[model samples]
Target: MTNPQLLWLRKNLFNTWYNSLLTIICIAFLIWLAKSIIIWTTTQAQWTVVQVNLRLFLVGRFPQSLYWRVWIVLAIASTLTAITWGVFSSKQHLTKRQIAVYTFIIAGFLMGLPGDLTSRSWLLLISILLAIGFGIGRKFPKIILPWLSLTWLLSFSLIIWLIGGGLGWQSVSTNSWNGLLLTLLMAAVSIVLSFPIGVLLALGRTSNLPIIRWFSILYIEIIRGLPLIGILFLAQVMLPLFLPVDLRLDRVVRAITGLVLFSAAYMAENVRGGLQAVWRGQVEAAKALGLNSLLVTILIILPQALRAVIPAIVGQFIGLFKDTSLLSLVGLVELTGISRSILAQPQFIGRYAEVYLFIGSIYWVFCYSMSLASRRLEKQISQ
Candidate 1:
């Protein structure tokens, strides 16, 4: 190592005898842990359980003929994600380290996948679409940014229609929606629906009207007090009793509903904290400018409030995404649910470590992406 590098490390990590001893111990432990994990992954892990059942892990019982729809959904999501990245980031340039990391991740994914032409082709198509979308966003960001919200709303509807299939397309049963597809769908739907409800609840909680304030308080407190598992149970089982005898909501729909309701309560508290942080003077200034309450809140207060709580809101969203695993316990075959089914198979019965580690990695990827995006968005907003 360079003399400067060694000096810097010595100053930071070995400034004292105790510090040097602790650093050495930590390094030893990390090396041992890495060696053990690598040994197990290389020799003991039976990845065939994942490779053979990749489809089941991804889309579950969704019809093979309709796999095109899943590919389309992925392509659309990937493109939108790229566009969002371009919109938020000032520069499209990547550092060498960032480029290397991204390349390694992409290559690892492709190499790990089974050698299926169709899967590879779909992934390649999505990658191309993502690149194109990013370029368009970089070129025409002002034009695209204004319409981006409406575009996202429309795309979500289109995704649902494609997946669920109605209006001239053959109707696929909701039961067929399982694994990662169901997990993402439920998380997306819940997050989207819950945000507005949460905002409204926050507003109502702080409203001038007593009735509205009390109602919002009651709802938020009741929902917050209950366990998420209880809420899921109520949505899945007890919800049916409230409906007409002939009418029944789809299980997936119910699960999303439960998630939305549960998330909104916590979201309300986060928003309320943000709302409290907003200065009263700002609202008064907006009102003095002849703006109505609605205009003042929407134009002046809401933006600042939401900006203040971006991290909290994004953390809640990540929690909501991970919480979708609970749906497996309630009988919806989401990622965790599908894992149980895969494990139930005769050959893969004892492969719990392999199955769980795979899903755990998938969960980590999404949660970390959300966290990274949150940090970027926060930095952009702060600037």
Candidate 2:
């Protein structure tokens, strides 16, 4: 290469390399300074008392007898996660950093630095099960499908057996269901239920039937117009009036119902956007082939629409996960609610900073993972 060209290349490299290096150094220094200040304030200056309460944070005031249910739920969630990972994009793998962080967090939970409030052994067992599930998902994707199906069947059967056989499984009231378990349960159930409802609503909104379209549109608009808190209140207050007098839904059920309805409205809009993205020509082509409208949608349009909207769907799921915290307003003890409860306790009084910070970190991790997964799926779909 000519010296002039070489000089130009050198200049560009110098600018890029020096700029990146400077940015990294600045960030590292800022982080170090922040850490130093925090250490000084917490330990040396005594600006804040650092009372580490890991157990109450993880499991809340969950009773010992029913502690196994929490672990069972975790195991079920892990299996579902592994199934989803395998089914959606088995070729995609977790990064080394992700694996390390997950392992470290689970280990920290098991160690229980402050005290053993919850069962560390159960947490550790669940962690191991999760790790095993992830390994199975990564290495043997084909086997995961059947395993997931079986697990789901067995789980439901167990629930039924508990209810039917009169095993006297000490029922943990929904009010007592607090902490991470409550958050996960609410988010998971809401997302699962909302997805199908959203798809149906989206389809209805776009349908040729005038009555169906109007009803769906009205429902979506009304729900979207109202704040979630209002809807939650409605669920708690007005929902029972609509139902039969004999059936009274619990507070958690009402909260879940409200969440599902609210989320589905937003999800419908997202799916409608995706549906609109389908080329008119493609729909026409399907019609020209004598396919019915349902077939055209299900066989031809819906697949393309969903693929184009996977990122949006994931975004909604993340939103729903965060919104689960809102259930606290209705007396549901999710993660944030549990954190607040902890802060109110005599032992952990005035430790809002630590407790809230910890809860925030947990939320960040889950939201971040969902975002990363969305980006990965986008890349895969593009290719």
Candidate 3:
């Protein structure tokens, strides 16, 4: 019998003399790189910096006694994620490879953090809830799908209320919100707010009215022209001058406002591209059917336009998420900012590589997950 692996190697890596030479050289370089990484990770790296400061990295100066609130929020998020996965991946079975990978990740986290039994128990419970939520979604997708949007909105409101702690609970100042918690909150709020604003801007830019179109174009162009850092600085410094002294905005709120303004411009351009991609024939067809302009736009044009630009829209979202790191520069302690603070400690003074590598891994996990979800959603929409 022909060896399939060998055949594949011959056909691909050894197809021509130059190809074979390039493949050999690439393999050598990769092997050397991998070996170096392994050696440094296993021998030279002191991961105590990461392990000891894990909580600080996750929540910054969040009160330890109030961690249960964070846990509840996490559980809710995990459950929602699982349900979404189940709905979209209904036809796909949980393969053994995927199961193994999930298990390995969970085990790695369990072994890594120096958390006590309570924390581990919370993690386990959240995982179990996620599984239960997935099962519910898979079993009743039709029933659940209709209410998913409403449920997500409610959950987001609940998350914000719990984190911010107002209207009955002891109010935690926004200044205390830091690290990954602040990062996620700012990113989520900005993403949610920016999308609708972007859609409106895109529509305005494409509108028949000269004034609206021109205003949209001017706003989009001016925002897109400025660097995000400059916008954030303006929000932090210049914004206060415009508002009354008594009406001080929280630093976190200012950062989120800046992010939304910056992201919405790019998002407007992305959505505009999608709007332009819609065929003129579709509009004509809808008009011929006696559909008014607004009806045609709402029912026919916008949906198709948004669907066509899903990838671009999601790409913009991913960029916005990563851009939260910039908040640290304006003095907000997001993930990257928190990592710098960690490195400033006496014991971890020289551990820049370890701290940054850990932070980078967190970023990769989130960015890759968003990219993966985008691909999955695109696949589902196509089907």
Q: Quick one: best lDDT, which candidate?
A: 1
Q: How well does candidate 2 match the true structure, expressed as C-alpha RMSD? A: 5.2
Residue pairs that clash (backbone atoms under 3 angstroms), model 2: none
List model 1 lDDT by residue over 90-146, tens digit each.
454666587457646764675456747888888777666766776677677778888
TM-score of each: 0.95, 0.79, 0.95
* lDDT against true structure, model 1: 0.91
Lowest lDDT sum, 10 consecutive residues, model 1, at 103-112
lDDT of 3 by residue, 1-383 (tens): 47998999999999999999999999999999999999999999999999999998999998888899999999999899989877887766787688557756765665455789999888888767766787787778888888998999899999999988999997787778889999899999999999999999999999999999999999999999999999999999998898988998989888888999999899999989988999999999989999999999899889999999988999999899999999999999999999988988998899998999998998889989999998888888888
Question: lDDT of each prediction vs. the true structure?
Answer: 0.91, 0.78, 0.89
- TM-score of model 3 vs. true structure: 0.95
Better of 1 and 2 by lDDT: 1
> What TM-score does candidate 1 reach?
0.95
Model 2 agreement with the true structure over 1-383: per-residue lDDT tens digits: 99999887566544587776876798899999999978955675421323454545566677756656655765676656755564556676678798779777866775564435455666666677766666666777676665665676567556434322345656555666678867876887788789989999999999989999999999999999999989999999999999999999988889989999999999999999999999999999999999999899999988999998998999999999999888888887789887777677686677666666678888999999899878866876686
Residue 271 alpha-carbon offset, candidate 2, angstroms: 0.3
Query: Residue 332: error of model 1 in Å?
Result: 0.7
